[model samples]
Target: MPLFRRRRSATPVPAPGPTPPPPSRRSTEELAAAEAHLSDFARSRPGVEAFIEPRTAVTDTTVVFVAASGEWTRRRVRSPQQAHALARALGVPAYDAGVVGYPQRMREWTRRRAEEDKRRLDGG
Candidate 1:
């Protein structure tokens, strides 16, 4: 090797094989769980609004339901597209949580719940 010239180390490169199909984000068990939760919410809560959260790098899409009383529930969904479809199928208006912030009613409900819990703990 000449001065100022670096020698390259030998390394074996593995041959590439056929790429596997992308893994599915939604599983059957998860879908079933979501359906059950949604069904219960619909039967119990009248006029529930849906909010669809889009997928991120680490998390899958999810659908949240907000009842008139501010009670809320969420479950994993197949994708953002499916979340919208689910809202339509459920006959509820759907908003994108990523685009618009979470509903005001939801925050209010959470606050009320927290306050109630605190009072109960204090025996008030």
Candidate 2:
């Protein structure tokens, strides 16, 4: 026999709480809004092209519409297929961003915008 016997606890240990649900995806309204925005972009910009960006750990699959002027917009899409379909519907040529890569005009446009922003901020 042991010199000292351990005493049992009067109360039972509590079980772990239930697991929380996973985060929900974008809603129908949100998807519609995204589509509308894309349509609007296509209508307003002359010579717009769609580029599909693959999904990443941080972001969902997205489509980027770049105009001839280099102005662009990006929005999350359900999948690459949907992006291509959207491009077709918009009557704009689509390309895989990973394959051909983004156009140089887009970078130049971004740079010009940044300069314009700086000038405005400085009241120049």
Candidate 3:
């Protein structure tokens, strides 16, 4: 004889909401354009490094380049592997943004740019 009896509910559990569609893949032309842009940036900037960002529900995989001056640019790529390959082709070291995070110089540059913009707005 069981000391306690389990109670069962007749109602069924509700289903979860619809899932979001994944980000669309880029066309060949788009990929080429992105590659060209990255190449140009790498060629023009000194001490540039690549940082690969993982794909998310809203965005595809992306690669970011940070130059010595802390100038940066971000562009989407086919995948992390492509990003690393591109970096290698560009002759720059590539790191996982999720692991290493962004460089401090990049933050400093952004802050300086913001300050400059604010000064201009204030007519200084």
Candidate 4:
């Protein structure tokens, strides 16, 4: 070892950068618009039922439309009121799945369709 020579350390030093800002919360109008858009999509699709799923996030609640065959479309809204409004505009019955649970008819239809598809795929 040479005298007055500096030893290099194996540890790496981290470089500092500016912290990112938190995500902005969606406004009520924005949420309502999203709900409307989703409802429109669902209504346009044949045999779809409009359903709402409540959420605790600041982004607002979610609105989903479950088709008779179990296919679904979803979007976020400001509140349940906005969801209902969108449902009415779409002319479909809107419901909270958490409270009412899934409709029996829709479930049965989906099951039958799945079984049929499986059988076809299996060539049985």
- lDDT score for residue 89 of model 4: 77
How many clashes show up in model 3? 0
- Quality of model 1 by C-alpha lDDT: 0.83
Better of 2 and 4 by TM-score: 2
* Residue 53 in candidate 2, Cα distance off native in Å: 0.2
Off by over 4 Å in 4: 1-24, 27-33, 57-59, 103-124
lDDT to native, each model: 0.83, 0.91, 0.94, 0.73
lDDT of 3 by residue, 13-103 (tens): 7889998756567789998999999999999999999999998868999999999999999999998999999999889999999999999
Better of 2 and 3 by lDDT: 3
Model 3 ranges with Cα > 4 A deviation: 1-25
Q: Residue 94, candidate 2: how far off, in angstroms?
A: 0.4
Candidate 1 residue-wise lDDT at 99: 85
In the range 37-108, model 2's lDDT, one tens digit per residue, is: 999999999999999999876788899999999999999888899999999998999999999999998999
Q: Write the per-residue lDDT of candidate 1 for residues 1-124, one digit (tens) a residue.
A: 5679866759866689987645766779979889778868867898798888876667677889998888999888787787787777878788888788787889999999999999999999
Model 1: clashing residue pairs? none
Deviation in angstroms for 38 in model 2? 0.5
Model 2 / residue 124 / CA error / Å: 0.7
* Candidate 4 C-alpha lDDT tens digits along 1-124: 7779977879977788886644537776876577667856776677676778876544447777777666666787666887788778777788887888876766776788899999999999
How much is 46 displaced in model 2, in angstroms? Answer: 1.0
TM-score of each: 0.74, 0.79, 0.79, 0.53
How many pairs of residues in model 4 come into backbone collision? 0
RMSD of 1: 4.2
